[model samples]
Target: MQKVRVLIVDDSALVRKVLTTMLESDPGIEVVGTAADPLIARDKIKLLNPDVLTLDVEMPRMDGLTFLDNLMRLRPMPVVMVSTLTERGADVTLRALELGAVDFFTKPPADLANTFMDHAPEICAKVRLAAGAKPRERAAVSKLDVAPRLSADAVLPLAQTPGTRGGTRIIAIGASTGGTEAIRVVLEAMPPTAPPIVITQHIPAAFSGPFAARMDSCSAMRVMEARDGQPIQAGHAYIAPGSQHLLVMWDGAKHVCRLHDGPPVNRHKPAVDVLFRSMVASVGAATIGVLLTGMGDDGARGLGELKEIGAPTLVQDEASSVVWGMPGAAWKAGAANEMLPLDAIAARLLALAHTPVSAAASRVGT
Candidate 1:
């Protein structure tokens, strides 16, 4: 594979030097150029045509957000934003995602002497994902594929009432790469009475809160970051905090969120595997596992575990996925029972979730 060519754009000379070095240190990535601000970056972008760009969210003459808006509007390409780890910075970085930026890496504290080196692996992964991500127009981002619509009848027979047959139903979802937007669309499409959802998205610590708040705004159900030991509830979605791995724990009859500080799985702290494995042990047949677009195969083996124990698993089809790595791997692993587009998965979940527990269990073996 060709090294992903990168151009570093930052106002701070030290940042430019450090970021360029950090990215180039990886054999898979090559630093093509460095610029102090968007102006120099613009000229270099045309000249060098780097495959990926790491841009500071705050820049000198032209604000980073403004430059991003123009860049996407004119020439669509994969770009990753470098943001400060603050509330304000988090919100702006979320905006950059909506503006077609592939992903972002938050800057460590000013006191952290080796910020780039400390987080070098994660930064390089983000750049690699960005370089391979599909570029779309700012105002006309591609809509998710919703082919072969599914209905409630597909999962639950109309002759039976789902309310009478089921125990507590829960939806557990995981995503990375293009997750933020994909998650928003899924949540927005959800009805008011959908089952409780626990999500593990690959995000940095500072951005998780803001990302949840952003999802809450666009979604009908309340969405927030998972707090340790918080009980999972219906009509709400809990997001795994960036630094912790989220798990579903059964406390007596109810399910709750559990956070772990273990080493990263598949190089992701809030790994999809952790959540899926937890649900397999905790929720059993009532768990609906949905794996969306992501860059790596973090969720494949875990989803396979879920499938092993008679749990339903769905993966976002490649026609709709931004990278198709996670879902594709899961499908190849015989983990995914249904491969649906982003728009169709929600309907399938709602349909299957409404099925009575007894009936759901019977179908689980399929």
Candidate 2:
């Protein structure tokens, strides 16, 4: 197989060198060139024609976002952002994703040469995934071996009982890689009074609050970071904090959000499986499980469990996904009862939110 060609763009010489070393460490990747700024990067992009571009979120001469906007509008291709783990960095990185970048790698504030190497595998894997992706399409797979991946059972066991027929219907969503933008699209299309929705997206702690804030600004529904013990309510969407696993639990009167700081499940603290399985226990059949675009199979099993207990499950189709890894896995596992494009998912979810659990159960897999 041909190696993935990459172009590194960063204003800092140290960053460019480090990124070059990291990319070259992977046999599957080849760094074709490096650029000191977006202006230089533009020339390199045309000259090198690299399969993928690893761009600094902040660059000299021209800001990264402006270049990204121009690139996507004119000559679209897969781009991954290298971002600092700062408030401004988070905001800019999120905008980069919106502007069509496939994914991002966050740089820690303190360390560069030492700490950054620890994440070498992650960044290289992201580049490989980005190489095959369409512009604005999220990358689909990650092969980082930083830790032994655990299941939702590590945080909370699969609930064996049937879901209680509910007073309030709940919607649970999980995504990674391309999830931030996909979630934005889904939430923006939701009506003001949609069912209570919970989300888990793979992100850094510094970015979660800003992500929630960004979602709230555009979504008709009230969107916020999930707080431990917060009551789940209609017309509101709760996003899992990047540092915690968000679970929905019954509190005798109503359902509430529960945050867990257990070891990362499937190598993600905010594992989609944990949230999906928690809904299996908390709402059972009253839950509507949806798996959007992501890079792994974290939520596939839990979604299957929801289907077993009579919840309606939907997955975003590949044509509309930035990455089809998660939804494709779930579909193969028989977890999803319906597969729809991104544009149609919100409306279908709105319609399914009102479907009786008994009817939903009967219709699934038919």
Candidate 3:
């Protein structure tokens, strides 16, 4: 097979050299060229036509974000961001993903050559994944300028008449790539009385805290990192902690969150599959599963299991997803009861949660 051609873009010679060496070690990848700035990188991109580009967040001539905006607008391709592991770096990296970056890696501190060495293999793998990734259409920047408003088309209204049976109301959500922003959009639309929400997102350890905090500040529900044994309750959103497995457990009266330090599932510690599986085992027919935009099929089978148990499942439609892999997989598996756009997801969740238990039970039996 032909090797994946890569272009390295960073102002730092050391970073370029180190990254090039590490990436070249993988026989499947080839370093086509290196550029110290976006202007030079632009010229190189036209000439090299590489399969992927590894970009540094900070550059001399043009910042990575500005370069990214231009690149996506003029000629879109897969780009992976290399960023520092600071809080600011996390924020920028998250934005970069939303701006159409395929993936990101946090470089170790200058003092920690050993740490960088330890993560080199992981970085190399991410580069490979980015090379094979599909580039998403750039999001409309105008949406960012204004606070998002809920459109009638964005939500499905709750059933007006009461049914004989109250329905089981559990929520399962999955996110990756541009999940931070997508999650914020859905969570912000929920009311304070929203049903318990379980979210599985792919994020680094240090960033999850800040991500959750940001969600709490913007959304009506209380948001926090998932703690083992914490009861799942209405008006709360539980985020799977970074680098750990978050599964649902039952304590008879209420559902509890459990954290596991087990091996990574589907190449993600807090994999959507792990959480969805636990929900399948614990809540079964009483669950409502949602598969969101992400880069892989991690949650497809678990969502299928939930569907098999008479639970309703939803997938984010491809047009609105940053990456449609996860939701697409669930849809293909026939796991999703509804396939809707991002804006419609919150309303669907609310409508499902509010369904009477008897009606939900009858639907499950059907």
Query: Which model, 2 or 3, shows the larger TM-score?
Result: 2
lDDT of every model, 2 decimals: 0.82, 0.89, 0.79
Worst 10 residues of 2 by lDDT: 136-145
**When superposed on Cα atoms, how far off is each prediction in RMSD?**
9.0, 2.7, 10.0
- For each candidate in turn, the TM-score is 0.87, 0.96, 0.80
* Candidate 2 runs further than 4 Å off: 137-145
- Model 1: what TM-score? 0.87
What TM-score should be assigned to candidate 2?
A: 0.96
Best by lDDT: 2
**Candidate 3 structure lDDT:** 0.79
Task: Give the winner by lDDT: 2 or 3.
Answer: 2
lDDT of 3 by residue, 25-75 (tens): 777889999999999999999999999999999888799999998898889
Count the clashes in each prediction. Answer: 1, 2, 8
Model 2, C-alpha of 342: deviation from truth (Å): 0.3
Query: Candidate 2 on 44-152: residue-level lDDT in tens?
Result: 9999999999889887779999999999988899999999889999999999999999999898687788778778887887899888776862221233347787988
Error of 2 at 153 (Å): 1.1
